[model samples]
Target chain A: MEMSALWKLSYGMYAIGTLDGERPTGCIVNTVIQITSDNPVIAISMNKNNYTYDCIKRTGRFSVSILSEKTTQNVIAKLGFSSGRDTDKFDGDIFAWEYMDGLPVVNENSCAHITAEVITMTEMETHYVILARVQDAKVTSDYNPMTYKYYHEVIKGKAPKNAPTYQAPEKITDKETWACQICGYIYEGDLTKEPEDFVCPICKQPKSMFKKQ
Target chain B: MEMSALWKLSYGMYAIGTLDGERPTGCIVNTVIQITSDNPVIAISMNKNNYTYDCIKRTGRFSVSILSEKTTQNVIAKLGFSSGRDTDKFDGDIFAWEYMDGLPVVNENSCAHITAEVITMTEMETHYVILARVQDAKVTSDYNPMTYKYYHEVIKGKAPKNAPTYQAPEKITDKETWACQICGYIYEGDLTKEPEDFVCPICKQPKSMFKKQ
Candidate 1:
């Protein structure tokens, strides 16, 4: 079986929002699918190990922030690359966000959002297929929703290890590269030639966070 | 609740293949999502009324032909516009297709296909959420997969009523148009103006099949 074939399956990137106690937390996912139209229900696959999955299980509610092409790589780095258990994903006022139905939705370059209540959840070996009923939804912007293909081919981003689509890194040989230790943004060529103030383009992390990969 | 907000959720077009007794049958859908990467499982939302759903229930297996940007509108009209219960979807040599793992996969303009076995299913009011384990899969082309947004805005195709995502027809304001009775393809001008030989651009059905809208 050609595992690469699975990459052809298209998906949209999303910031799944939920609350950890009174604190808002979430993670990025690509497996949200609308299963029913009337009383619209959506199913999202979340890794069991994800901190956001535990938050959703406790709160029994979640929100979907539909990421669009305008969403910056920093938003992905803040929400997707880091774990909520270790640090506040929304700290430092990194993402311009707002509260909707008591759930915090990352509004930076998001086109729409849906607040949902967990109706049921089926446990998979590696993930939880959580089915949620849409409680309320709103269109945030008119920008086109970003497809996973666009994220990979255009933004040149890689999936986080917690993502269901995550694959082990393949050996890279294009040039000497510096990769962000926080997010996996690759910086091509010599890092020493850059200015002292330079930071990771995607994660906005200082040069100290980059390591030769 | 803004129903249009649901439109912001992105999706990919796929031709779902299954078996009718010993014959091959399938339909087009936009709700296939990979649920897990390890051992790679997927879930597809199919309306209970669809013939392909019944086929999968009985056969316990199906294939997903990932349609790419290169896929023609005719392929969507064939598998999407017609009923697999009576019509031979694979008949009339409509698509250049072949079998993979004893399942017919529509190859024309397909980027990849996954043959799967249904492990379990949850029945909703109008649809069934089927969880299937990947038996085998292959990448057929390197072309980018066609997204549902591209199908609507670029290909100008409309969804069949049976689709969970189908929206009610919008009020039309253009010069009197004719629509295909089978595929709902709108002809911008008078169908009578074209030669009698002219057929529906999407379904290729004769002019007699058009109805003034």
Candidate 2:
């Protein structure tokens, strides 16, 4: 199969927030689709290994924070590249969030938030397709929701390894590309030209964390 | 719940092509998502009432035509608004298509095509989540794939009743708007000023079929 063709299938950037015991924990996902109109059941693909997946499976409740274009990459760095098991994704001042239905949701810059209760968890080889029914939802802003295309092309973000749409970084032979070791974000030009304080846009890692490719 | 918040969940415009016995038939869908990256598996939600759903269930194989921005609204009208049970959607000269892995797929103006074999069909309250493994796929063009936002905001096209994301046409009170009776496409202006041959850009219906709001 020509796997690259699958990249044409579009998606949106989202954070799946649920509680691990009393701790607010979550991770980034790109595959969220409404499965029905009335009562609005949405389906999201989560890798089985995701800590957030275990939380949602146990709690039976979760919140979908629909990330917008204006949403800073810091949100992705906190909730995506790192594991919720070790890091308190919502504890610091990286982004503002609020509890909806007892689940933490990104409040600032996100376009909307939907609280849902899990209805079914269908197992696949490497992922679980969690189907949930909408419990409550609200529009947070008028910002355009960030699409996977915009995230990759405009923000120069890289998908987490657990993402269903994640593809390996292509080999670069034509440019002086530097890849962020923390998040795999590629800096296309000479990395030294930037300020000493310049960090990886996607992961917020220091310049020292980037290695020449 | 503020149901309008669900609009922030993003999606792509696609044509799900499958066979009705020996004839070719399909419909438009916005909820196609990959569930795995290695030996990619995709999941698509199909409303139980759709004719194409039964066809895919019976045949156990289908093709996805990743529609691009250049793909005309005619493709949506032919494959979306009409039913394959009564109408031969692919018989006319409306669009170009070809068979891949014994299933028909849109050829021109589409970015890619993927043929898949059904892995499982999990029943839901109003729809069935059909999971399939990719059998073959090919990138057809370099054109940007169309997102659901672009389809509604730019093309002014309405979703079919069977779609998971289908929303009722909101009442427009502020302006002189005319809605196509066939496809529910809203044209925001006096319909009388257009040329005699000005068909509804969505379903190609005559101007007489439009009703002022």
Candidate 3:
């Protein structure tokens, strides 16, 4: 099978939110599709390793923040690249968010948010297809929803290691490249000549987090 | 719940192909998402009323043609707006297609195609979430995949009545509009002034299919 064929499938970027006990925690995901119209039901694929997945399993509910074109790469980096087991993902001032139906949701640059209660969870090898019934939904802004294509091409962002669509970075033989240890974002040019305060745009990590390849 | 919030969920345009007793039959769908990466599995929502759903359930196999931006609106109209049970969707000169893994798939203006076998079917109120494991997949072109938004905002296409994302056309006031009887595409101006043999760009139907609103 041609594995690259899978890349042709289109998707949108989203931030899935759920509570880890008393704290807010979540991660980034690319799969979210509506399954029914009346009493709408939606499905989202979450990696078994995701902390948010464990939270949803415990709480039986979650919130989906539909990221917009204006959503920053930092939002993806903070929620996607780090583990919620130790760090607090929603504690920083990087993005604005609020609670809807008792679940935290990103609202700063998101177009809409939907809170759902889990109806069923179908297990696959590495992921779980969580089917849920929409309990509450509201449009937050008029911004256009962000497609995964826009995140890759326009924002020059890289997928997290646990993402279903994650592909290993291609070897760069033609340029002096620096790979960010935090989020795997690559710097194509000389990192030493840049300012001391330069940080990885995707994950907001300092230059010290980059390693020359 | 604000139903408009559901519109923020993003999706891709696709043509699903399957066999109806030895004849090729399929329809257009917007919900297709990868559920697992290894030995890739995908989930697609099919309305219970669709003929193709019965075909897939019986045949236990199907194909997905990832439509590109260049795919004409007529493809959506023929395969989506019409019923495959009574009409030959791929028999005309509207679009080019070929059989892959014994199932017909649209090749013209498509980026890739994937053939799969059904693994499970989870029933919902109005739809079934069919999970399938990939049998074979191949990239046919390098064109950008078409997102549902592009089909609506750029091609000016309307969703089929059976689609999970189907929304009733908002009443147009203060303008002369003509609606297609077969498909709900509305022409914002007078259709009588176009030509002697004007056709609806969406379904390619003749001027006779239009009705004044």
Candidate 4:
């Protein structure tokens, strides 16, 4: 199979929020689909290794925050590039949220927010397909929901390694570049020339996280 | 739940082709999602009542034609608006296709085509979520794939009742108009002023199929 052909499949960006014990934790995903209309059901594919996946599996509840073009990359960097097991994803007020039935939902730059209870899960080798019935949902903003394609081409974002739709690393040119060890954000320049305080703009990782590539 | 919030979920438009006994049959869908990257797997939700859904259940193999913005609206009108059980969708050459592993794949205005064998199915009250592993796939064009948002706002297409994503009919403006009973193409202004041979531009159905709304 020519795997790149799958790129034609469209998807929206979303932050799946669930709690790890009492801590608000989540990660980014792009495979959410509305399955049924009446008492609508939604399906989202989460990699088995995702910390948020374990949280949802345990709690049986999750909330989806639909990210839009206006969304800051920091939200993705904090929740997506880093593991919720080691990081407090809701820290430093990177995203605004309100707790709904003990679940945190990020409303900043969100087109909509949906809370659902897991009804079923179809297990795959690397991922678990979670089917949830929408319990409560609301439109948060009129901003256009960010498309995965837009995230790549417009925002120049890279997918987290654990993302189900993650593609293998692409061939890089012979240009001097510094790549983020965490998020793989390629800084196309001579990194040594920049100040030590420089950090990965996409993932907000420190300069020490940069690897010459 | 505010179901309208679900509308923010993005999806690509597709022509789902499968065999109905010995005849080639298909329908339009916007729910196809790639679940895995390695040995790619795809999942599509089909309303249980749809004829094409039954066909896929029997055939065990199906092809997905990723529709592009350039796709003719008639492809959707024929495959989406009309029932394959009653209409020979491929008879009128409404779409261009070829046989792939004995499954019909429409390639006209398609960004890609994927042939898959059913791995399993998740049963829901109103739909069946078919998970299939990609057996063969090819990128056919460089055209931008048609998104469901573009299909609705740009193509002005209405969802067929059998579609899993089908929404209730939107309120129509009170005006002198005639709508095609077959495909819901509304013709504004006095319908009586049109020629006797007037037909729904999208569905190619005759004026007799129109009803004042």
* Candidate 1 structure quality by residue, lDDT tens digits, B116-211: 999889977778899999999899998768888878865664545444433322323447877777786666667788998997655678999988
In terms of TM-score, which candidate is stronger, 2 or 4? 4
Ranking by DockQ: 3, 2, 4, 1
- Residue pairs with clashing backbones, model 2: none
Best prediction by DockQ: 3
Candidate 3 per-residue lDDT over residues B119-199, each given as its tens digit: 999999999999999999999999878888878865563545454433333334467888778875567688889897898
User: Which of the two, 1 or 4, has more DockQ?
Assistant: 4
Looking only at chain B, model 3 earns a TM-score of: 0.78
When candidate 1 is compared with the true two-chain complex, its DockQ is 0.35
What is the lDDT, from 0 to 100, of the residue A63 in candidate 1?
94
lDDT, residue A113, candidate 4: 89
Q: Model 4 over residues B134-182: C-alpha lDDT tens digits?
A: 9999899998788888788655645554444333222234567676787
lDDT of 3 by residue, A18-75 (tens): 9999899999999999999999999999999998899999999999999987776657
Model 1's alpha-carbon lDDT is: 0.83
Candidate 4 lDDT over A14-123, as tens digits, reads 99999998998999999999888887889999999999999999999999999987775556766788888887888775557788667898877789989999999988
lDDT of 2 by residue, A162-193 (tens): 44433333334377888788876667789999
lDDT of 1 by residue, A75-193 (tens): 78778887889868876655699899999898887999899999889887888898888999999999878888767855554545444333222223457878787786666689989
Q: Give each model a TM-score.
A: 0.81, 0.80, 0.80, 0.81
Candidate 2's displacement at residue A58, Å, is: 1.4
